[model samples]
Target: MNEPRSTYPFIARGASAELFDMGGGQALKLFRDSVSDEMIAREADASAHAAACGVPTAAATGQRIWDGRRGIIYPRLEGATLMDWISRNPMRAGWALDRMGEIHAVMHRVDGGTLRSLKQVLATDIAYGPAPDALQRAAIAYLETLPGGDALTHGDFHLGNVMMTPHGMMVIDWSKAAAGHPAADAVRSEMLMRFGIGPSDWVTNLWRDWAARRLRRSHAAASGVSTRDIDAWRPVVALAWLRARDATGRTPAFMRYLDGALKQAGLPFTG
Candidate 1:
């Protein structure tokens, strides 16, 4: 496909790509050259598969080449992300978190359909993560005993990845889409909310902790997955996160939380 004209206004930039407002009610997600074609292709396929399975996401309308970088076109979605909305309407955080939980449950209802396995993804991450050899082995062995499922999982699901539009909430960024147990995905979401890079002030940290609990409760209720099941997946997920987490965000509180999860799951500490 032809590169978008210089006139296409810039919209936003993320870790891997820059978005442009492609005229005609569409947006262009032009990925960086450093991003592999295979990764981009997986995201494109996963996005289409998700939409076909009735997941609320912007399906790729087309693919294009902008200069040397690859890009995908999608129907432009208008509105603030769930994160931004929550920031602006802190009083409604409960409602928003509840809605997010419900939406996540609904997404998990669909079959992953040819997507990569979430367990394998987690195992790979843990194998390559910073955990001690014994800890990694213990976590991977433990991971094997956990239940697996074909349910669709938005591997990177969180408030920031969800958009609150006029129609409703639309999930974006399928780069990390995978098939796995709903409980495992829920654990991942909990970790992201509590420890992912962001403001770490005491107030924000308290809110984050509360928001994670609220989201987990909502998801458990909607999905019929127990908190115990989610907890069972937590240690491995937390271990794998060490591979990709921002060092700046690895504060003392996060380390304590990680240790608690590991201890609860009977896994070795990272140190």
Candidate 2:
């Protein structure tokens, strides 16, 4: 099919050589400023797969070339972001979180019908990929030894990745989709919540404490996982946190958080 003739409104762009626009009556992700073609293609592939699973998303409507970069376009999404709306309606706080949890649960169930795995994602080379072999080996040994579960992981799940609209909540960004233990995803969400926007000091503290307790409870409730197993997985999530920071350069905040994770991993902390 020929690409849409209407120029989409420029909504966003990423370092990976893409400029996204919303003028085609839907959001369009065009890869122009891509750091690498592989990253854009990986995300596009994952987006297609995720859509196949009945996940809410802008359909892969068309493709176009811009500034010598290939671009894939999806229909524009409709609705106010849940995060944005929540600021106006504080009463929906609990409901928003509950809704968030439900979508995530369904997403985890979409793990099947694909060969995606955390190992494969980790193996992908970034500008400063994954971690040293010691980190990967240690993490793999731990994940391997643990009692496993079948679940889909959004790879990168956080408020920033979720959008709320009249239809419902939808997920964006699938560059890191994989099949993995939900607990690991849970742990990562908790880590990124710190990097989130908004939340006054008191409110942030309240949510952090609430989230921590929730995680402890979830870990306790998960079957067949001993304290030692969870402890071992600790490094996996922490290392994954470091991997994210490394993939993107260490922002001031990221560096600070890595210190906490490294301190937990018993590695010499770097900032």
Candidate 3:
């Protein structure tokens, strides 16, 4: 580990923070830079919120500085992230997938657990931008027909976000947390899993199938999301991609999605 022993650090490399291997299996997640304060705080906030809601998670029971940066000291979780485990366990894929759907539903009600720095601003700065008269008309019309139901969105939940532990599994990374439409979050999540699994094969399809079946069984009204729902969020998510808002390694494809989304929503790509 690059970090020193006195600080007792290990490395976890959060999307916005650098994790160091602390002594005796503990870990310290330090800010990569000031730009990461929001992200760093997001982890702390989500972990605490999970505890408050009685969700199982790594106990972030301490704090300290390491590698010339400030961070939280969390009890180092044992075992690989769920993705690692899933890679070698195709036989258990079905049960694992069903478990993920339950996790998603459980997590959706978390208090602002789906909140994010970029998402809240996206609606104001990008999605609802002052467009040409024609574009504005299109968006307004689309919104009128769109469904409205808010829930905690994990912003970027997937198997990778899940950590397998001796006790069970735990969720991590709250930078994408937000309170908003549930399907938007789920669709974005499903897309993230797409690279790992295709539309027809792999765990992505399995999870989607499981989630769809679960939703159908669910009492909550969560059935309208489909290719249509993804198309709905695509223009804005595409703009986010074009602007390099996220490091999801998917800007080109998302922009491609933008054109398709425009066509699906009954408009030509003005940009």
Candidate 4:
């Protein structure tokens, strides 16, 4: 349990972890006390697995306990997150989204090997989520009928999780990696881009909707996964999301979207 030096430069903080510049081109991701050992282990293992399988990500180089908190060290990656880049270069959002879609397609080509099943994860979330028991039961039953796959799915893939590095786009944060159908993962990405926590002004939302559409088209083209396949998974995925989403993400618009998806999929509506 080596402690980080007091001189280590603090970098940034996220909901679950804090980052520090450890010099020598390394960075430490120190998890908060609330983060479980299982999650930390999963992220380390998943990141290494993704890198070994040719996914462009920074694998954990080492692990340490600092001040009783778990930390993983990774080679410092240089560049802004794809989300940040898009914010700064709004006019080039389409190009950036195209690249994001292509990269995601490439990632799905790899096998998830031994990672947790995506369907099971979703079922669990739906079971514990805010949906009515009837809806939860129906959603889980329908989810079982959907096709399954071993493709590597970045459970939380989004623009914010990808970096536009000098070397190219590199994905970060493997905490939610899973083995699942690519289309399901694609649907999750759509939800994130369209409804994840962010500014919700009418103009911003319109752009977000457009961006989500562009990304879906690009991913579908590159992956040979049809929009129908993605759409089929939307209702269940949206229901599962209710378990973990914050209040800001529970807007009336999102509820309507969820209702629409459920209706489209022939599942019981939230009403």
Rank candidates, lDDT, best first. Answer: 4, 1, 3, 2
Per-residue error at 50 for model 3, in Å? 2.5
Pick the lDDT winner: 4
Clashes of 3: 16
* Model 1 alpha-carbon drift over 4 Å, by segment: 1-5
Clashing pairs in 4: none
User: What lDDT score belongs to each candidate, Candidate 1 first?
Assistant: 0.87, 0.58, 0.58, 0.89
lDDT of each residue in 206-236, candidate 1, tens digit only: 8899999999999999999997887888888
Candidate 3 local lDDT, 131-235, one digit each (tens): 455665555455545554456566667777777678777877656666666566665565555432324434555554464444323313333345556567655
Per-candidate Cα RMSD to the true structure, in Å, reads 2.2, 5.5, 5.3, 2.0
Best by TM-score: 4
TM-score of each: 0.95, 0.70, 0.70, 0.96
How much lDDT does candidate 3 score? 0.58
Residue 17 of candidate 3: its Cα lDDT? 67
Runs in model 2 lying further than 4 Å from the true structure:
1-7, 13-24, 32-34, 120-137, 147-150, 195-232, 246-271
Residue 101, candidate 2: how far off, in angstroms?
0.8
Scored against the true structure, residue 96 in model 3 reaches a CA lDDT of: 62
lDDT of 4 by residue, 1-271 (tens): 2335667888877778988888999999999878888888889988899899898999998899877778999999989999899999999999999989998998899999999999999999999998889889889999999988999999888888999999999999899889999998998898898888778888988988898899999999999999789789899988988999852734787889899999999999976
For model 1, the local distance difference test gives: 0.87
